[model samples]
Target chain A: MSGNNDYTQIDNLLREDRMPHIWCPGCGLGSVLHSFLTALNKSEVPLDKVSVVSGIGCTGRTAGYVKLDSFHTTHGRAIPFATGLKLANPELKVIVFSGDGDIGSIGGNHLIHAARRNMDLTVICVNNFIYGMTGGQVAPTTPLNARTSTSPYGCFDRPFNLPKLVTAAGATYVARWTAMHVRRLEKAIVEALLKPGFSFVEVIAPCPTQYGRKNRQSTGLAQMDYYKENSIIKHGADTKDVDIDLNGQIVIGKFVDIECPTFYDLQTEILGKTFPHMSKTQAEEASA
Target chain B: MSRDGQLVGEFFMNGDVASAEGAICAGCRFFAGYPITPATEVAERMAERLPEVGGTFIQMEDEIASMAAILGGSWGGVKSMTSTSGPGFSLMMENLGLGAMTETPCVVVNIQRAGPSTGLPTLTQQGDMMQARWGSHGLYGTIAIAPSSPQEMFELTITAFNLSEKYRTPVLIMSDESVGHMSEKVVIPPMEQIEIFPRRKPTVPVDEYLPFKADADLVPPMGNAGEGYRFHVTGLTHDERGYPDMTAEAQDKLVRRLLDKIELNKDDIIILEEDGIDGAEVVVCSYGISARVALLAVKAAREEGIKVGILRLVTVWPFPDQKIKEIAKKIRAFVVPELNAGQVVLEVERCAGGAAETILVPHMGGAVHDPDVILEAIRKGSK
Candidate 1:
């Protein structure tokens, strides 16, 4: 995809005043944001036909920065809000941008449910392991024994394999990529957007200030080094495959890719067959 | 519109059933709720009826999901609602704020039941009166209507939808178990006389519609998820451009307008009915089932040649300050009879000033207040 488009006419859709964003220097959130905008810029998705929704966290701030239809909703409820937006108007490309703490913890239930229903939404979760915005609290996806401000003695809870969870929960498309894999991340987003069901992409982002400081990887460069060295492509890793110690970890690729009936499709099928006039677009398009 | 067309007349149904029918008549295509006592009938009725109307009905995992799904359904461009009581209402407070901040229009029915923590699930209580107004954190305006009977439940439930769309804000239909579970008759209105309000749609082409643009009416036009008018919405304070603005000036401007939409439009929003107050020395003010009890008290007092009146509040949130202030001057005493200890009475005191002496006819929970309890207060006030 070409990097250039009508985006330059706006001189970066980001709020220059809100910049340098609250994300720590060298944090991958900026890159993720860039890649997302580029994806939107490259794809046929109209700027006016997209709604970006986010929950509370550093990554959740993506909605604030993105110059599009965005909703910076309450913590853990962005998925529900996005679901509402999607159901309200299925034609709009509803994407959920949230942090691990917001999605895997407070919003975990919504995440799984939206997936189970095969709701047509693309969820881009920035997994920084710990809750960065709230001063590094131990989150649901925090690795066992990983230290955080809240977990002074290190976290005891096991981390969630987000892609795996969604895959099992019935997401049609599931993929994961680290901050270092910008191209892959962009590709995953493009693929997710093109798919008809719940598409989930868990980006392992670096929170150098909070999650990193406590875990002895305080610098963004250091965190990037960890991703570059530690991640391995298992080719066909299962959602049930657990990562431990990072001692010989093989990071998964596209874990789940299958065709399932999506909420939009089901709605079109049921409502179209029943209330022919109510399916305005479908009837018109069909007749046309 | 002929009055007879709208007059289905009253029949025997519980408050919850009345609310459900009202929702259906209001063009609600989606119903998402969990089964809790008192409010269960609303869900049951919705489940049976929504499917028949070719609408969607889902029993969510919990109250939180129920609230979430309805909010989602509304954005999906369908009118949606949910019902709950005490503990369930408490669970909904967080997402309720989300609905408020996002300016999503949906209906929430809270059938009052006793509680500090699940005090009485099956029995009736008006304890949640205050919680309905200020339960959610942060500053925002809410619309809550109280219904005195199954007839009012049917009527107000529709009114709640109208207000929700007109204001682009969530509206609550407050009822107690007594009204919710009791069997009574209600009339569904016909097309013309029964007013309906739909959310304002963008007319200035999709791209030009700023989702948060404060219009002449103060409500920004709402373009649902699929309408192709992509606009941003956020819980954080945002400018008219729909982008987050965190400055104090921005917060002040945004929050002020959030309150001002209802505040400045009080005449259009506030609903109160005054009875026999022309020369009354004392007045009885009540709402919901208690209002019915207070009416009987006023009638009995009038029979004994006591000058008394009744002010029944239908819209409780804007608080009818002007009406209360005006009535306070002529009436020497004001008696508030409520199913709860004393919730709305405080607002009455605020609005009444010192023009009239205030009295509280408090009922803890369970049974309804007797007319004599309120009548005695009226008799004492007259003496």
Candidate 2:
């Protein structure tokens, strides 16, 4: 809390000294981080037992700012790192806070595999639609025909419908929200934090310096206005219908929430059946 | 058997299986690996044996995930390891840098095959020696041990784990296909006879702990993920508090300590075995499978009445520069033999510093060196 500005309520969870964060003036990463911290505060889980993991990007800096046992891992590898963390210490509540490019492109294999295994983790992905830190390159979530540093002629490639992708990949909980929907996003995060298996919440946020200015939404407020106009909250909507396009209707809601035995639960059950004398506690003690 | 049911007896096993057994004996309770040639047996063995020992074995999506997983497992307060070959090792380089920067303790085994890019999947090569040293993009020191046999693979994997724990850095066991697949008798000692080095834990309360604050030994005590010590770690240039400090000064302080932690302790970390070096005219310098071949050449040179000796490098990185320098001053010439075209020999030539003639016996590397080729180099070196 020893800093120039005094925001006492949120200061306990933030590394204020690392402030003057690297996000752009009109960027929405700050809002997403704030919502995450608030949701973390509201959850009953012990802060000391919670570990935050992030990959490389503007959003990845979230791990550095959080005052927890956080890991700022390699680009696209946060899910795997968090997977290891959760598997090694089942008592720990592991959360991955990264960006769409990191979780969808190079790290897509791990993302799908983790979901397929139904790993017990909460993943918060900020989809800015462009690679912000790398100067607005086309990202996997970049809408078709969106102008980018690499795609000056307007990108023609198909962007992934992440909600549909994760839902198909077997994520037990899936949701999407814009940064404009603060309360709703916070609530989604809280629910994801409480869920038992492979919970994913995608926050569609503004990258004013990157995706925004190029797409004519030059300010965060303008992007918020866009969300206010175009976003539709359809809870229980079919995940297949959640595709986003430029100036098109953006579907946002809690699309999936069901349950299955998590990776650990299944692993422990199989091991216990195999080794009759082996209980979870006995296994942990043996490891110790 | 130990509490983990690790067998305690001598048995014939390949280097990969022995490596897994060695890790289990060293108290490594977490393994994350992918299936790759000459190294997949390590993963297969772990998959079969880890469950019996109450350890966890996860076959990750790829080498990148495997490497990242072990780092995560290490932070969760377990000894963790991974095994891979050329392509997988290439995939692991980025996260290996992450492990070094974060100072996470883990072991990485590279059962190398000939490769510029998957050249020969089932053949032997010692080409990765340089990659093991400088593959990751950064200024950092590395610890890599080269094992010549199944016995050495078992013995040195345990050593790799111990060094990794003591230094809080990722240690590499660089075994080539020849050693990795070769079968030999390995003695698994009783649990009481083996040594295990656990990570140094913080003595202070959670409030007083700084995650990256180094002790006098330049290694910080680590805390587990869920032990109520909510500390932060990142791959960025960070301060001792483990918070990102994007400054030249912070980079200088942190990078220097990361390098110095291993570099300054080179004497304690480097392992070299020497024989018949008292006033020898020529010394055959080599490691891994090539070291065994070079030893046969040295013995052949002795039979031919030439004054030649052998200097085998067990710990290949930290590069035995001082030892080579000292030997270069006394020897007439050095014959360096390796499966690669010429990797570690370059180190010998550089460390020799023009004090002695250095000859490289290069093999294209589908197989071990012809002993007579090294013997011929020894004869020329003696001349």
Candidate 3:
């Protein structure tokens, strides 16, 4: 396989409509999409074998852009669609990309279920703190007291700690990185793609046009600077220490990793005992 | 002829068990269903027989999961099925559209009960006739079958599986509680005589295969997951490669084919049975449990010095319009008897071309219409 350094092939995989994305001039979503295409290109995972699934919102358009088998589904429902796709043809590499609104709010149940099932796929959630497509509405992952179209009185509800949520929901692999950490984000994407079970990487991207302007942050470039200043290099940070608000909060790194059996693996085990020699492999061969 | 020309088989069973036996005989090996009344027997029987035949059965969390799981199982290279009643079938609509858009082949058995919402769990009604055709939110077509007996349930279940595979669309087996709970003799066919429909597999090299590229037939050959024929699938209107493209042109092309694939070939997909009516002035059209009663009414009407014929719709959707039109010219009037207030009756009227007078004979939850009520409609239409 070719090395990751050559990004020329990645250009071929970028979607045309998704060309000038809706992200802020320097928004991390672009970097994430770039890194994603890079991983697929570098891994030489044939574009034909990949099926990208996304939900409604700005990031949801990734499905439309990706030059592969993609499902641009309804809001927050991308996981279920991806779950169906992966379960149907385990050979297809299923990846889900969406915004916080898509993943944490409408699709929250599917996220938890997919995590618990430990489905073999990758989930890339671009956390921009607020809904961008609906013109900066307060999102489920919006920071405490953040101002937005929906939360004029400031978001009173505490936002979700997404990594912690998935960790508790039984995701086998969890990682977090900011938009400015392009190399780290790209590596995470590559690792998640290779992981045999459910892998989640919550990329904290900056919506300079919406959240950044409302929160009184600098331009998109300056927001990238904040990500650089705030993030620490520790890979094993405690969940309690990672915080997105005032007082003491460390932007957490890799938190939990366990080896619980995935839904399909355990499913095949029960099936093997219940119906000996009825494995899908045998059935497919016989049918052929 | 064979030594046993009549061919012997008989058993007392409920509607759900009969449907499950039908699926098994049809070569269905993957089942995902959450237990619901009047439909639970189908799932239970699958749990028992699917294992014996080296097939798999899963109890999903809900009907939505059941629908999604079956879609997955189908793509995973198995003939998959799910059974539910009205409430569960209602929950399955969203994903049912998903199956339609993705063009996945699977069987969904709706053993209908009385309901606006769970009106009668143990009773029968055919209220979901329209839902079976248009419950999903989209412009896709559906193939629905209404079986009147345990024997037809077994036979049509196989036919549903075969049609679904042939067209790469979801097939609906709409059975009411009356037929689901009732039992009579159903012959179990010998293995050699049973006809099974397998989905078309890709014959081209793995690299050359495009999952959604249509051949002479609108259906492209499908490759099972994990078999190395890598292809993408999506819910968006997409090109033949299964990649999402956001353009009016793309949507127009894709949606047209999705609608045309079934519409253009309606003749190949529609199935109905006709009785009497060579020189009859009136005809009765019905399906499911009502068809059984209609059959009896047709017999009784003839004995009572009235000329009446029966038109039994084996395939409820694609709605048998051409057959109805042909019969309309021969008959002076049409009578449709159904468990619902009026569903298929409306379709019968629309397709009868204003030539035949169409009358609706409606029944509600848990109630089977008296044969005399249909006889009256026949009498009125005959005159």
The models' CA-based lDDT, in order, is 0.81, 0.91, 0.80
Docking class of 2: medium
| Per-model TM-score on C-alpha atoms | 0.91, 0.96, 0.88
Number of the top-ranking candidate, with TM-score as the measure: 2
Cα-based lDDT at residue A203, candidate 3: 87
B1-383: candidate 1 lDDT, tens digit per residue: 13321225445677888888888778787888889998999999887676556577777667887887788778778998999999999999988887887788899999989887878888988888889889999888888999998888898999999989988888998899998987877776565557789877877877677787777867877877656554566778888867777899988988888888878878898888888888999988888888887888888989999998888889888778899999999988999998888999999998999889889999998888888999999988887
lDDT of 3 by residue, A1-288 (tens): 235568535655665644566555756677788888887776666556677778889899787666565666666767765676566556678889998999999878778878988888799999988899889998888888888989988889888888888888888888888878877778778878877678898988888888888887747887777777777766766555565771113374666566777666766667778665644442254357
Candidate with top DockQ is: 2
At residue B135, candidate 3 shows an lDDT of: 98
lDDT of 2 by residue, A1-288 (tens): 324343224667888777878888989988888888888877757888899999999999899888788899999999999988987888889999999999999889999999999998999999999989999999999998899999998989899999999999999999999998988999999999998889999999999899889999999999999999999999999998999997678999999999777787778778878886554642365368
Q: Which stretches of model 3 miss by more than 4 angstroms?
A: A3-24, A37-50, A67-69, A89-93, A190-196, A232-234, A237-243, A246-250, A278-288, B1-12, B202-210, B224-230, B243-249
Clashing pairs in 3: A69-B232, A89-B225, B15-B180
Q: Candidates ranked by DockQ, best first?
A: 2, 1, 3
lDDT of 3 at B237: 77
Ranking of models by TM-score: 2, 1, 3
